[model samples]
Target: MANIGIVIPAAGQGKRMGAGYNKQFLMLMEKPILAHTVRLFEESDFVSEIVIVGAEGDISVIKELVYYQEFHKVAAVCIGGVLRQDSVRAGVRALSPTIQRIVVHDGARPLLTLQAFHKFLEESREYSAAIMGVPIKDTVKRVDIAGKVLDTLPRDYLRAVQTPQIFDREILEEAHQQAASAGYYGTDDASLLEWMGHPVQMVEGMQENIKVTTPEDLLLAERILTQRR
Candidate 1:
């Protein structure tokens, strides 16, 4: 139960965020976004250790934050690659050999409340692989490059997938290896498993579980954080 290891991929440059630096370093309610993300798992009873994958330039920054915050669960801080997939793989490799389960989450998404996190963890225990996703509440559409409506996608089967994707260590490692060997770059970790013919269960996620990609997203996160507080 305490063998669960969490990998946080914080290597994204956040070019769209226009922060002129890694957005995860940006403060949210007086703490770094990445710090907020890690603290959730650190406080959880299920997680035993953590591995953070960051850019080469941000390694010291991340290490400093972990030390200052007294995040004793941090096992390693590894250099990440250009792609998110590569960063996740690096983090997975940093986990201890005894860790039988892995949870990969985005460092920018700091608003994931402990209640939701533990709920997902509890409900996902019966599955080999599980991910959090929210049902698409809005009307959907499929459009072409010319802005022409091709077809209206069914919202009933659509979901906006969020992170903290949980997987068995052995299967996740194998999925990464297969993807690397085949030169397949997937949109997310679940997609990699999907490509490898693995069934991934989708548990209901919160609407506020959004990844901060732009400045607007940061503002929205702030509001949600305040509300949560």
Candidate 2:
């Protein structure tokens, strides 16, 4: 069995959510969104450690949550940076040195299933990098900066990527290091690997495995939880 460490970047202000605070601190069911996400990994059999990277101001709250919840797998709570990528980088550095695999996941995504987690981890052993994504069901259009439609993107060739993206610990660390040296910024953790020419595989992700970013998303997340119950 591989020793896996999960890095959760939860420092975003989520200005779009209009919550006036960190959206991860918002309530999902009876618990905060961040707590729900942490509980998932905390219960995973394959995960050996979890490092949560959040804004410095929220570190105390995160620590209190972990302490009160008795999240034994939570090994560290590191301060985050301005960008999401920066937070992930900090989390990677904060993980236990023994961890062989790294998983980067959004702290607001609470609907990820154990099946997806297990499948990604199993498949990652064969591939250096793997992530969960869903094929686009709706037609997508490529537009210019002025909002002029340039071309219609084939949905077949497109995928809406989600987390948790898994990667070999060394590979991810190297990718981040190279990206930093080159002054490159990737939209997601896997994009950094892609920039390094790493072959990344995708695992089919559930549509319900959505990031809680907006008020509408929160409502849907509640409905999903209710349906599950």
Candidate 3:
């Protein structure tokens, strides 16, 4: 079995969440949102180690949370960079060289399931990289800066990508290196790999696995948590 490590990026300021504090540190049910995400990986039998990349000032808080919660699988909690891609790179670099595969998940996505995680890993075994995504239900339109609709795009070919993206360690590392060298930044890990001419497969993701970025999302997350419990 390949040594699988999980990289969770929790350094985002969560400007959309409208919360004074970082969204990851916000309360979700009885615990912090990030704690729930960490616990999920810690409880999973397939996850060998977890590396969390957080904001500079959040290391002590995250460490205390991990210790208090007794999250055993957490191998390292390192400071993250300004950008999301940079944070992911930091987490990936923190992983042990022996780790063959890595899964990058969002700390705000607290509802990620074990089944979805397993599926991503299974897909990564066949494809060098795989990410969770859901087909866009609404019709998309290409609008200009002035709000003029340039084109109405068919939703059939569109999929909203989600996190918990799994990749072969070497492939991901190379992609990050290429992006850094080219002074390029991607919105997600898959984007970086895709730009490098790597085939990135998409696995259907669950609707419950949402990134909590707004007040409405927080409410939905609470409901999902309650239903799961």
Candidate 4:
């Protein structure tokens, strides 16, 4: 098995959730959503190390949470940058030199099943890069700023991408380096790889793997997590 390291970017200020603080700190099932996410990776035998890139103000809280929870896998709770990509880059830098495979997962996505993640890793072993996604069920449309439909996108050609995106450490590092030079900002890490002409494998993911942003999403996540238990 390859040595794995995880980068969880939790620095986003989720204004949509209307939470006074960072939404990841919000309680979910009697625990913070970030704790749930970290614990999931901490419990995994495949993962050797984990780094959480948090906002400047949240670093102290994150450290306290890790210390209290005894999250041994967490190597550091470093300060993040302005953009999500910058946070991910900072998190990646915090990993140990021994880390071979890197997994980039959202800190808000606490419902990622270990079984699902293990299966994804297994299927992604042969490829240098792979991402989890689910086929879109709803009809997607390209709309103009004026609220008129520009074009209807074919559902078959689209997949809603989710986190726990895995990549070879060296290649991922190189992609980030090149992307920074080109001033290319990708929506996801896989997009950075694609921009560099890397073939990314798409593995099937569960619909429940959602990045919690709004209050409605939090409720749904609780319901799903309750069902899992």
TM-score on alpha carbons, each prediction: 0.98, 0.97, 0.97, 0.97
Scanning candidate 3 in windows of ten residues, the lowest lDDT window is 116-125
Where does candidate 4 have its weakest 10-residue lDDT segment? 1-10
- The count of backbone overlaps in candidate 2 is 0
Against the unseen true structure, what C-alpha lDDT does each candidate score? Answer: 0.94, 0.91, 0.90, 0.94
**What tens digits encode model 2's per-residue C-alpha lDDT throughout 116-199?**
788767766788899989999999999999999999998888999999898888999999999999999999989998999988
Could you tell me which residue pairs clash in candidate 3?
none
For candidate 1, the clash count comes to 0
Model 3, span 1-229: residue lDDT tens: 3468999999998999888778999999989999989988998888899999999988999999999999988999999998999999999999988888899999999998877777767766787788999999888999999999999998888899998888989999999999999999999999999899899998888878899999999999999989888
- Worst 10-residue lDDT window for candidate 1 reads 220-229
* lDDT by residue for model 4 (14-130), tens: 999999899999999999999999998998999999999999999999999999999999999999988988999999999999998999999999999899999999999999999
Higher-ranked by lDDT: 3 or 4: 4
- Model 4 TM-score is 0.97
Clashing pairs in 2: none
Reference-based lDDT, residue 76, model 1: 99
